[model samples]
Target chain A: MQNVTKSKWWQTMILKTIAMVLIGFIVFGPLMGTLLWSFAEKWFWPAAFPQELGLKYWKIAFTGQSPVLDSMAISITIALIVVVLATLISVPAGYALARFNLPWKRILLVLFLMPQAFPQLPVFINMTSIFYRYDLVGTVPGVIAVHLVISLVYSVWITTAAFKSIPVTLEEAARNLGASRLRVFFRITLPLATPGLIASSIFVFITSFDEFTGTFFIGAPFIQTLPTLMYTASMGYNMQYASVIAILLTIPALLFMLVLEKFLKAEYISGLGV
Target chain B: MQPRAAVKRPSIRVSDGQREAVSGLVLVLPALLVLCVLYIYPLCASIAGSFVSDEGIGLHNFAKAFTLYGTDILFTIGITIITLVLVFVVAVLTASFLRFRNWPFLNFVYRLPLFIPYLIAGHTMRVFLAPHGILNILISRVTGLSDLPGLAFSWIGLVITFVWKQFPLATLLILGAFQSVEDSYIEASLNLGGNKVRAVWEILLPICRPTVLVAMVLTFVSTIGCLTIPLLIGPSKPVMLPIDMAFRINYMGDWGVANALGVISYLIVIALSMYYLSYTVKKEDA
Candidate 1:
């Protein structure tokens, strides 16, 4: 028994060490590589580390030389607009789905979820073709419209959960007290769900901020976002420039990660893959 | 709990039901309208466009797509399957580790990718998997071998990128599931002299089967629609379906073939998603 336990313990030690090393490398290795490349003044073949490291690429990246700054501006602008629009559309829909007696409730919920559940590339491709008819293709508004598809997943689903979580009786009591229905909702439901609504908004912001597929399909070759800029730079073999912007984009994600654990419900994350 | 207002307006309550129904429709209308315009129309257009071909309204586009890009479809299937299996294994192990241990840093590290966009995942792999890149450098140093070729621009690299991208979410889901599994169940196996792996396989996994299924579904379908990882790390020749669709549309001006490929991709999603959709619906109803 002692021998068996001893050998088993040793085996576990070896296995755990291997697992740690592999996981650590898998998760962090690429990040380290990107960080090194961003500052690699003169990395060459056969050198495991950069021979020279400085912020040369970083300097060029922010200046008029690179498309980084403009892409950042456009990315933020579209995300903010999508956040506002998606929220307006979703809050009522979410509340109706959650607290009201709606017709075809299940089907409506399913329809709202179709964007997250389906293969979006096909939809985006067809959108590009359809948008051409209205001359919306390759425009900033076109990109924002495309972004609404994915951002709605966050806004609608999370808001539904938010409103669903608020006790229905609070709204009922306000209504019973002779408050108008609109007043009841605004005073009770909206304020009560505000924290979750804010979280939902942040989730929407991050998703729109990082949206790639639709932007690629609808806004590419004309309007450039950080994602498209990364694609072009990487394709053109400007690894350092791509790395710098990649790190820039990663900042919001990194910040949210600290707080994500609180909002990181399994249901919410199920909508992640765009 | 029974604090109803004694002087409640029964008349208002009766009319309130009717008003509620109207408001429900009005409130849900915007999202449904956006869904109609954004998703339903585009979807109908894609399906309709797929039927338009050189031979006129049939399987010509599909036939051409299969003849031209059959290998790419197979490649995509290969990548998805391989990534699914790897992601399942890794997720289970990571979730198991989290279940058995209390390492906060490791937990944080494992879940970080869940917060990231697929763009970063793709870009990170692009930089790391490039020829003469860090992965190669490390391999050469470890094994005393040099001149390793890049896996960055290949199907293997695509799989790696996806596993990295998809596993964190799977791990998050699986870990959440594992957290709810009664510790006494796992403890019973450990008390029987069973190892952690055995306990996981015999006790934990069976209990968490539904979550495992959900995680697998998420991992499987994710690779199908993905464009960035494939674009960044995939080989130029015989690319993934999204890449092929983009090329056909952007370069060849062949919306028929592109939309055909789109339909084919959607069919894959539909096949897998029927279960997922029903599952989600059931959960929603619950």
Candidate 2:
């Protein structure tokens, strides 16, 4: 029995070590490759690594010559706008859904979720007429509004969980204590659910920031976001420029996720029973 | 508990009329107005345009998109299947590996691509797999081969890139699903003398069946409507549906046909999403 147990333990450790190496390869392979390529000078066929490496492409991408700056700026603006608008729209709606026994809740849930499942291509094509009619195409706000359709759904889903996590007894106690409804809300409820709200907003921001399909359809030739610029740079066969901007755009998202790491527990978001 | 907390204070009361009006305006009015102006109206216009014939009301646009040059449809279907299969197989393996392993840094590394946008992923691969690119160089070095294989600008490369970009998300979802399986079940399987492969197949796989289905459905819908990867690496003969639609609307200025294609893609996506949404909702209720 001792021999069997000892051997089994060793076998399990070996299996674990092998699994670790496999995961390491899977994760870092593409990431390190991209990072290396970003700094390569004339990295083309026949060279395993770049013969000469420099900061030339990074300089161009940061300067006015590269479209990345404008694209990044516009993407940030649009994402923030989407986050705020979605919060405004979803907060009360999510609260009602979570707290009240409202009629048509199921139907409303379906309606709210309908846009998420539907492909953005159809919506983009459909919005062309709106663009022409209202002269809304190619504008940053126009792109932002189109993005809100999806971002709003994300905000609603995440915020619903946030709101549901707030206990009912707290609200009832505040009501009974002669505190006005507004005081109870802004003080107790909002502060308590701030983490969830922030997490949901982060999700909305990421969704809008990384949105490519709608931005391509609406913002082409006019308003450039980071993804759109990345597309154009790559389309022109400027791989160096694309890589530089790709790295630049990825930085902000990674930073945002890191900052919110303490609050936005993956289990919390997933455990909302969604 | 505070003695005052149990009492329902009637001092801070609002009139019922004001309450009703505020509720109506707050809950229903803005949403109804926005839907009318933004979503409902545009969709109606697009639907109408799709049916308008050269002369009058007809299904010419739909017919053209549906039947005219069926190659686009075939290409889209083919690429979608390829992407789905590649992503699923790779994701399952990666997720399984992560579950059995305790490499925190490796887990973090696996998620790096999730932060990178699709365009960046596609473009980086486009460069690295160029004829004179790293992939070909490595190939030549290993085999002592002279001719550089420029496989980057092909269907295989596109599928590979798609799998790389998407597998992380699939792995994460499946990993979550795997974690939900009770440890007792695995212990019981081991006690019964089941081997690792058999235990995984019979115990873990069956338990994670729903999540696996969810992952597959998500992959199918996502790949079927891809615009970036196909545009980047795919050839000219067989264009994916999204690329073809973009060409018609943007390049050729054929809005009606583009909208028709869009509607078809939308229907497929919506059907899949509804299946997932309803399934989850039902599962939660049960």
Candidate 3:
């Protein structure tokens, strides 16, 4: 009996360890591969590791000689613009939806969900023709407008939930205490909702940064972002350069995720549940 | 405090209600304008473009699209289904473990992939799964399995990349569901002489059905419309729908066929969206 129990304990331990190791490899193995390749000068077949390592690719990506630095700058600029615009647009709309018993509220909710739920290819294709006619193709603002279509949905949905989560009584109490409406909003509501707002902004920034197909359709030929640059380089057989850019693009997203980790529970419940 | 004063206050109350309504409309106007111009108009124009060609108002372009790229449509559906199944299995297992187990490192590992962009994830997989890539190198060294099957630019590679990129989201969502499930139900099942597997299958899964369904539908919709994974790691022959539509426009300048394909993809997503919307509505009502 004792031997059987001991063997059972060993079996469970071994199974748990196996699961942990496999999950670790599946999640981190490819990441490690990209990291090595970014610095590798001569990695080839039948070798367990790279034969040589250098920062040539990294240097090229950082220097202005390559398109990478410019593309990175373009991506950041576009994402920042998207963050500001999405926040500005979503806050009021989210507030109305959360606080008011408006007509067609359900229809409005569905309308907000449509951009995210529908296929983007059709929209991108259609926008290409309109953009061409309006002379908006190959322009930064054009690309930003298209990205807004997607990011706005996330911001509105998230901020709506954010507003909904704030207790209504707090605002009423402030009003009863003779606080002006604007003062009540600025002093009571906004501060309490800051975490959700920040989370939504981070989400908007990431979505805009990673947007590709729409950007490719609208911003090609004249404007280039990091994603489009990576696509072109990889297609053109420049994997080393692509790897460096990939790492550079990943840094901001990872940092946001780390910042978001503490707010994960709140964000998940109010921001992402819908 | 008298009747005349009450009458005056009622008139003011009516005006206040009207003002509130007007302000609410004003608040939502910008979002509404963007949706119309950027989303609704473009989608309508694309669908209309598909039906109206030189012949004027017909399914002729759709027929042309089908005859030209039927295999691509089928391939996209197949890939979506496969990725959906794999994601479901992986997410369920991982979510269960994370919810029930006490391993902090495992939790961190599961969240690692959530930060990665799809394009970067594709590149990472390409580097690792290439013909002479790190994975093959490691396998050859350890198991004497040289010249193992290459995965880059293959359907298998695309599936692996999609699963890796998407399953973390599924796990996060499903784990949210799992955390809400009561431990007492599983305990009751155990006390009733059921095994752990049976307890999970009978008690927990049934309760989490709606959430799991939502997660699966989301995975299906997103995977079907995906471009980067299929474009980066997928094969050149039987391409995915997004890639096919993109090439038709970018390479051939065939707007008619591209718009037709676009309509087809849109219809599929719309159908799925309707189902999801209904589910949410039903849940709300319940």
The two-chain DockQ for each candidate, comma-separated, is: 0.55, 0.38, 0.56
The best candidate by TM-score is 3
Q: Model 1: how far is A41 from its true place, Å?
A: 0.6
True contacts kept of each: 0.72, 0.33, 0.65
- Stretches of model 2 off by over 4 angstroms after superposition: A1-25, A64-66, B1-25, B28-37, B193-210, B270-286
Q: Evaluate candidate 2 and give its CAPRI docking class based on DockQ.
A: acceptable
Candidate 3 falls in which docking quality class?
medium
Residue B223 alpha-carbon offset, candidate 2, angstroms: 1.2
Which scores better on TM-score, 2 or 3?
Answer: 3
Off by over 4 Å in 3: A1-14, A267-272, B1-19, B270-286
Model 1 DockQ class: medium
Q: Lowest lDDT 10-mer window, candidate 2 chain B?
A: B5-14
What does the lDDT come to for candidate 3?
A: 0.83
Q: Model 3: DockQ against the native?
A: 0.56
lDDT of 3 at A97: 78
TM-score of each: 0.89, 0.86, 0.92
lDDT of 3 by residue, A1-274 (tens): 9999999999999998998788778888999998988898887677677789999899888886888878888999999999999999999898887777567877887788777666788789889989999999999999999999988877887788888788877876666667777798789888888877888899899999988889989998899999999888877768788888888889989999889876544543634454
